[model samples]
Target: MIVGEQKPIAEIKEMVAPYKKLLVLGCGTCVKTCFAGGEDETAVLASAIRLVSRKEGRTIEVEELTVERQCENEFIQEAAEAVGRNDSVLSLACGAGVQAIARRFVTKPVLPGVNTTFIGVLEKQGLFTEECSGCGNCELALFGAVCPVTRCAKKLLNGPCGGSQAGKCEVNPDTDCAWQMIIERLKILGQLDNLRAYVPPKNWNTSTSGGPRKLVREDHII
Candidate 1:
C-alpha cells in the first residue's frame, strides 16, 4: 500500500487561512490505513481548524467529507456537489489523489494535506516499512521473494557487498543485509543454485525514470 503522513496543523492552517469556505476531503484507502487522511482524521482536522480560526477572531466554515477513494473517478464523482460548494479543497490523500481531484476540478484549488511517503507494508500496528520501489519489472522469483533492489542499500544484484558484517548492512547497522536474507532464504528453500544465473543490469527505463506510466486493460475498455 502507499504510505503517507499528514502535514502539521500549523502548515495546514496556513494553507487554508485565505479561504473562508474550505472543504477538507479525505480518502478512505491507503491514507486511511496509515491514519493520515480518513473520515475520522478529516473531522479532527476540521475541528482543529475551526478552533484556531475562532481564536484568531476569524470566521471560517469547514466542510468535511470522505470518499471511498480519491484516485478513482467513480469515487471522486461522489464528492462533486460538496466540492462545487466549497471555495477551496484541502485533499488529505496521496499525491495521486490530490492530482486526480485537481484534474477533475480544473478551476478549484486543490491543496495537498499529506506527504506521500512510499510503497510499503504494515509491519505491525502503527509501523509501516517500505518494501517495494515499483521498478515496473519484478524480480522476486530470482531472489526467494526478497527484493534486493529495495532492501539493499547499494541495490546490488549479484551478491552481498563485502562491507556486510554480522548479517547486518554496512550502510546501516540497524538494517539486515538484504543479500544475507536472500541467501538464507535460498538455502532454506534448497534453491541456492538460482544465484548462479547471472542477472543483467536492471532496465531503469521500465521505472519512473521513463516518466509517468499507464496500464490499459483492453478487455475492460468500453
Candidate 2:
C-alpha cells in the first residue's frame, strides 16, 4: 500500500487561507489504512481548519468528503459535486490522488495536504515499513524474496557491503541488514547456491523510460 503522512497544521492553514470555501477531500483506501486521510481524519482536519480560521477572525467554510480512491476515475467522479461547490481543494490523498483530482478538475486549485511517503507495508499496529521502491523491475527471486533494492541502505545488489555487523545494517544500526536476511532466508530454503551466480546491476532505464511511467490495459479500455 502507498504510505503517506499529513502536512502540519501551519502549512495547511497557509494553503487554504485564500479560499473562503475550501474542500478537504479524503481518500478512503490506502491513506485510510495508514490513518492519514480517512473519513475520520478528514473531519478532524476540517474542524481544525475551521477553528484556525475563526481564531483569525475569518469565515472559512471547509467541506469534508472521502472517496474510495482518488486515483480511479470511478471514485474520482464521486467527489465531482462537492468539488464543484468549493473554491479550492485540499486533497488529503497520496500524490497520485492529488494529481488525479487536479487533472479531472483542471480549473480548480488542488493543494496537496499529505506528503506521499512510499510503497510500504504495515509491520504491526501503528508501524509501517517501506518494503518496495517500485524500481520497475523485480529481482526478488535472487534474494529469497528479500528486496535488496529497497531494503539495503546503500541499495547494493551484490551486497553485505562488509560494513554490516551482527545482522544489522552499518549505515542505520536500527535496520536489519537486507543481505543478512537474504542469506538466512536462502539457507532455510536450501537455495544458498542462488548467490553463486553473479548478477548484473539493475537495468533501471529498461522499464523506467525517464518520464512519467504508465500502463494502459487495452483489454479494459473502450
Candidate 3:
C-alpha cells in the first residue's frame, strides 16, 4: 500500500493562513489505513486549524470531509460540495491525491497535508517499512520474493557484498542484509539454484527513466 506521514501542524498553518474558509479533505483508503489521513484525522486537523486561528485572532472556518479515495473521480465527486464551499482545500491524502484534487478543481488551491513516503506494507501495528521501489520490472521470482533493489543499500544484483556480516547489513547493522535474507529464503524453498545464473544490469527504461507512467486496461474500458 502507499504509505505517508502527516505534515507538521506549523507548516499546515502557514499554508492555509491566507484562506478564511478551508476544507480539510481525507482519503479513506491508503492514507486512512496508514493512520495518516482518515475521517478521524481529518476532523482532528480541522479542529486544530480552527483552534490555532482563534488563538491567533484570525477568523478561519474549517470543514472536514473524507472520501474513499481522492485519486479516482468516482470518490472525488463526493467531496465536490464541501470543496466548492471552501476557499482552499488542505488535502490530508497522499501526493497523488492532492494532485488529483488540484487537477479537478483547477481554480482552487490544493495543499498537501501529508508527505508521500513510499510503497510499503505494515510491518507491525505501529511500524511501516518500505519494501518496493516500483521499478516497473519485477524480479522477485529470482530472489525468493526478497527484492534486493530496494532492500539492499547498494542495490547489488548478485550480492552478499563483502559487507554482509552475521546476516546483518554492513552499512546499517540494524538492517538485515538483503542478500542474506534472500539466500536463507531460497535455501528454505529449495531454490538456491535460481541464484547460480548471472543477472544482467537492470533496465532503466522501464522505470523512472521516461517520467510519469500510466496503465490502461482495454478489457475494463466501457
Candidate 4:
C-alpha cells in the first residue's frame, strides 16, 4: 500500500493562510488505511487550522470531508464538486490526491496537507517499511521476491556488496543487509543459481524519464 503522513501544523497553516474558506479533504482508501489522511485525522487538522485562524483573528471557515478515493478522476470530481463552493481545499491525502484535486478544480487552490511517504507494506503493527521504489522494473523473480532497489542501502542489482558486515548493512548498522536477506530467501527457494544471472543496467528513461509518467487503460475508460 501507499503510505503517507500529515504535514506539520505550521506548514499547513501557511498553505491555507490566504484562503478565508478552507475545505479539508481526506481519502478513505490508502490514506485511511495508513491512518494519515483519514476522517479522524482530517477532523484534527481542521480543528488545528481553525484554532490557529481564531488565534490570529482571521475569519477562516474550515470544514472537513472525505471521499472514497482521491487518486481517481471520478472521485476527485466528486470531491471537487463538494468542496469547490469553498474558497480553497486543503487536501489531506497523498501527493497524488492533492494534485488530482488541483487538476480537477482549476479555480481553487488545492493545498497539500500530507507528505507521501513510500510504497510499502505493514512490516508489523504501526510499522510501514518501504518495499518498492517503483523503479518501473520488476526484478522480484530473480531476487526471490526481495527488492534490492529499495531494501538495500545502495541500489545494488547484483549480490551483497563488500560493505555489508555481520549481516547488517554498512549504511546503517541497525538495518539488516538486503543482499543477505535475498541470498537467504533464494537459498530457501532453491533459486540460488539464478543469482549468477547478470542483470543489465536499469533504464531510468522507462521509469521517470524527463517528465511525469502516466498509464492509460483503455478498457477502463467510459
Q: Tell me the TM-score of model 1.
A: 0.94
What are the per-residue Cα lDDT tens digits for candidate 2 across 1-222?
A: 999999999999999988999999999999999999999999999999999999999899999999999999999999999999998999999999999999999999999999999899999999998999888888898899999989999888888798989999998888899999999999999999998878887788735455678878999999
Could you tell me which 10 consecutive residues in candidate 4 have the lowest summed lDDT? 202-211
In the range 1-222, model 3's lDDT, one tens digit per residue, is: 999999999999999999989999999999999999999899999999999999999999999999999999999999999999998999988999999999999999999999999999999998898899999999999999999999999999999799899999999898999999999999999999988989999997778886888889999999
Instruction: Report the lDDT of model 1 for residue 12.
Output: 91
What C-alpha lDDT does candidate 1 achieve relative to the native structure? 0.94
Candidate 4, residue 207: CA error in Å?
A: 0.8
Q: Pick the candidate with the highest lDDT.
A: 1
True-vs-predicted CA distance for residue 164, candidate 1, Å: 2.1
What's the CA RMSD of model 2 in angstroms? 1.2
TM-score of 3: 0.96
Clashing pairs in 2: none
Q: Note the clash tally of each candidate.
A: 0, 0, 0, 0
Off by over 4 Å in 1: none
Q: Find the number of clashing residue pairs for candidate 4.
A: 0
Taken over the whole model, the C-alpha lDDT of each candidate is 0.94, 0.93, 0.94, 0.87
The sequence of per-residue lDDT tens digits that candidate 1 reaches over residues 1-222 is 999999999999899989999999999999999999999999999999999999988889999999999999999999999999999999999999999999999999999999999999999999998889999999999999999999999899997989989999999898889999999999999999988988889999889999989889999999
Worst ten in a row by lDDT for model 3: 204-213
Q: What is the TM-score of each candidate against the true structure?
A: 0.94, 0.96, 0.96, 0.93
